[model samples]
Target: MSDLLANLPGRHLEAWHYTDLKALKSFAFAAPAPAAIDSALLPDLAMNRIVFVNGFLDEALSVLPAWARLSSHEATKSDLPLAILNAQHRQAGIAIDIPDDVDAGAILLISISQAGAPIALFPRHRISLGRNAKLTLIDIAQGEGVYWHNPVSEISLADAAQLSHYRLQDEAEAAFHTATIFADIAASAAYESFSLVLGGQLSRAEFHARLGGAGADIHLNAAQLLAGTQHADFTSVVSHDAPHCASRQTVKSVLAGHSRGVFQGRIEVARAAQKTDGYQMNQALLLSPHAEIDSKPELEIFADDVKCSHGATIGALDPEQIFYLRSRGIPEPEARAMLIRAFIDEALAPVTHDQARALLERAIEGAWSKLVS
Candidate 1:
């Protein structure tokens, strides 16, 4: 554990260049101690609920859906430093499996942290879907106090399976969060994920996905709402190893005050990955002069017959649009908020799940209020 912590990536690594971990060295974060659970942290949904208090799975509070089955498993070792840390400190985790042709309704997985001092929680989860299975997973992370929430999730989909995954991170203002998601998509499978990040003092969400079979489709989309001096980084790497696979990514950020937002997206196409289609775009709207956004979109293609493209844009609210709104009796703050919402709505258009989309929309509205105030 000490060696892994010593080798934590810093600004030296290109992947971690925009977001450095040097500040973490100054704080001594012990393993999170068990605390009283708060039911308010759980969303008021009738679907299956899985609660993890400080990284340990709470079977007493978890309510499994009819199509979902829970089991125990050992954590997988990884070369990544954060993954290694999670594997070492993780206490209890959940492994869920969905049978073929089952449409598992909304399943909520909540991770809550309540610690007195600087602490850390490493929670691990795995989801596997059989052939032709479909499921929707809503992952929420919230907490109070100064702590670190480090979570790792592994997902796999069989041939023709489909999974819609949504994640919301609204941690405490003083919290630090680092999350990693690794997904392996099979032939003809469809995997879609949308993430809304609105909290944490300094947060970084990293996603790495591999298209392991032909005709597979994957979409990775995210929105970040930041205020004050908060920093949020969304990094992703999508690898296409099979032919006829399609991948798309769209990331949007709304920054206020002195907050900083970073988007690093990479798409890789192997030599044999012919007929692969990949698209990525990132756009940011800054609400204050001191706000900043750093976007890096890269595509590495070794195949000849593949269509891949990437683009990024950063700017403030359009003065003309804001003026038009203000002329119609809308206040300056309300006009700005309206424009910001419209800008972000473009990236969120692809989300199809009703419940998930509504949740993200609400988060965006709340974020807009904070940004304008």
Candidate 2:
């Protein structure tokens, strides 16, 4: 533990280039203590809920969905630094399995960290779907005090299965969060996910998706809203190892104050993955002069018949658009906000889940209000 703490990931590594971990070295992290949370803080979703307080399951507050069965925390085969660290102090985790051909409607998994001091919490979760099965997972993370919330999730979809995973990260203003997700999709399977980041002093959300069988598809999309001195990074890598697979990514960032945002997206197509179609695009809107954005879009293809492309754009709000809105009797503040909302709408368009969409909109509204004020 001491060695890992002393040698935390830094900017020297290409993966951590945009986000540094120097500040994390300042805190003396201890094991998280048992904490309680207000029920009102939970989202208003009409589904079974699994709540984790300080990285430990709160069985009293959690009701495992009827279509899902909970199991023990299984071993992880990850080489990433954060995942290794999570395995070190790994506590109880939520493991769920859905059988073949069953359509599991939806479930909510919420993690809340309410600590009084600087502590560290690690939560590992796994979800697997059988052949032709379908499921929707709404994962939300929010917290109260100074702490580190490092979570790792492993997801697998069998042939002909479909999984819709949505995430909302609205942690405390002083919290540090780093999440890693791994998804494996088989033939004719689809893994669609969208993550909205609105909190954490310094946070990074990384995803790795692999097309292990033919006819697989993946959609990895995300949006980040940052204010004050907050820093947020969204990085993803999609691998197409089979023929006729498709992947798409669209990321947006709204920066305010002195906040900084980063997006690094890479698409890899193997030699045998012929007829692969992959596309990635990242756009950022800087709301303040001091705000910063770093965009890196990459494509590495080894297939001759694959269509892969990547693009990135970074700019401020167009003055002409704001002026046009103001001329229509709209205030300057409202005008600017209208444009920002329009920019984010494209990324949020893919989310069709009613409750999940509402949760994201509410959080985005609150973050914009706080950012401007």
Candidate 3:
């Protein structure tokens, strides 16, 4: 364990060059102790609730729906340091299987961290949707503490399966978070994911997705609202291994105070994967002079017939738009907030779930208030 911690990636690794983890070397993190479940921390949604307190699943608090098959299981091993740490230190996790042709309304999995000391929690989740299955999942990480939350999720979608995933990371101001999602998509499968990052002192959310079969479609969208000294990184890699597959990604960040944001996205199209269509765009809005944003978009295409493109943009809010809003009787702060919200809403346009979209909008509003205050 000590060796793994010692060998963690730093600025040398191209993937983590912008957001280094060197500062964490001084913090000592023990295994998180079991904490009581607080329902108040959970989101107000009409869905099955699965609660994980200090990274351990609380069966007593979980309300399973008819389409969910839940059981205790260990996570798969991975070479990534954080994933290795999760597999080694995870106390409890759940494996959920959705039956074929079932339309599961929604399932909410909430991870809460509450400990007396600065500790670490590893939560693992594995989800598989059978052929023709449809499901919506909302994964949320929220708590009040100075701790490290490392989570890993493995997802597989069978042929024609559809999964809509929404994630919210609203940890405490002092918390550190690192989360990764590995997904394998099959033929005709549609996987859509939207993530919103609002809190945490230092955090990174990553996704590695593979289109394993033809006709598969994937959409990855994210938004980050950072203030104070908060730092957030959104990195992803989408591989098109099968022909006729499509993938799209859009990421946006609104940085204020002395906060920093990073977006690193890569799209790879294999030689055999002809007719592949891929697009990636990352944009950032810096509201303060001290705020910083790093954007990196890469495309590795081996197929000549594929259509692939990547681009990034960074700028501040449009002064003309703010002035126009203010001229209509709106205050300066409110006008700025409105423009910021509009900027983020464009990235979140792909989210189809009404409730999830509303929740994210409210979270953005709350974060904006803090930034403009």
Displacement of residue 370 (Cα, Å) in model 3 is 2.3
How would you encode candidate 1's per-residue C-alpha lDDT over 133-184 as one tens digit per residue? 9988988898888888888889999999999988999898989899999999
Runs of candidate 2 with Cα error greater than 4 angstroms are 1-4, 66-72
Best by TM-score: 2
TM-scores, each model vs. reference: 0.95, 0.97, 0.96
Worst 10 residues of 1 by lDDT: 64-73
Candidate 3 residue lDDT tens string, 240-338: 999999999989999999999999999999998999999998999999999999999999999999998888899998889989999999999999988
- Look at candidate 2 and tell me the lDDT of residue 297: 87
Model 2 agreement with the true structure over 72-129: per-residue lDDT tens digits: 5765778788888888777777887889999988889999999787888888888899
RMSD of each: 1.7, 1.3, 1.5
Model 2, residue 324: distance off in Å is: 1.3
Deviation (Å) of 287 in candidate 1: 1.5
lDDT of 1: 0.86
How well does candidate 1 match the true structure in TM-score terms? 0.95
